[model samples]
Target: MSKLVEEFNDYRTRMNEVILSKNNLVMKRLWNLDTNTYEEGALDKKTKEMLGLVASMVLRCDDCIKYHLGKSYELGVTTEQMYEIFAVANIVGGTIVIPHTRRAAEYWEELQTNAQ
Candidate 1:
């Protein structure tokens, strides 16, 4: 598994053990209400993912960026397209995405045989 997925799963396991509800409560509320405003809005999936990368960059979420970048590639996002995405990030969010870019590279290096 990608480390991002593993980490997220590990976090989910720990959170399940804690019996404390958090982090996703608000999103859950939205989910349960069937109000996928974000999903239903103007953005398409690939575009949304690109924006997700931008948000991850702004939030300095290295794992998130790594995860999304991999998924982005799987979705046929080209390197040049990613470069364009990076240009957008640089213009709007600046250098915060650098660590995420590095994390994405490392995660790619660590990718196994896709057995997971």
Candidate 2:
């Protein structure tokens, strides 16, 4: 498998473990609910991915942003959509998102370079 694919799988596995293990109480409380399902009604996959990308970016999780950006693109998210995601990120995550926004952009650019 390609290194990128392998790394993504590793991240997936670890994220799953963290969720299952209740690595953080907030994670368990907020995301691990039984009502949590992929049923986003009419929400398209790209929209959901865009939401995730914004969240990861605002949260300053490079690993998460990298994975979600790849997933978002695979789901047909355009660069324009990414810009929208950034806007929503700032709106939702607020001032603390400034630093994370910079870092996420750096990580995203790094990933693009590595892919070349």
lDDT of 2 at 83: 69
Q: Tens-digit lDDT track for model 2 on 1-116? A: 44655677788889778776866877666664522433355886667777778878777787777778777656666666676787889898898877777766655555555556
Model 2 C-alpha lDDT versus the unseen true structure: 0.69
Clash counts for the predictions, in order = 0, 0
What does the lDDT read for residue 104 in candidate 2? 60
Stretches of model 1 off by over 4 angstroms after superposition: 1-27, 30-41, 108-116
TM-score each candidate.
0.57, 0.57
Clashing pairs in 1: none
Residues 13-115, candidate 1, lDDT per residue (tens digit)?
A: 6865564356577666764553243354677667777887777777777756775676676676766787777777767777766766666555644443243
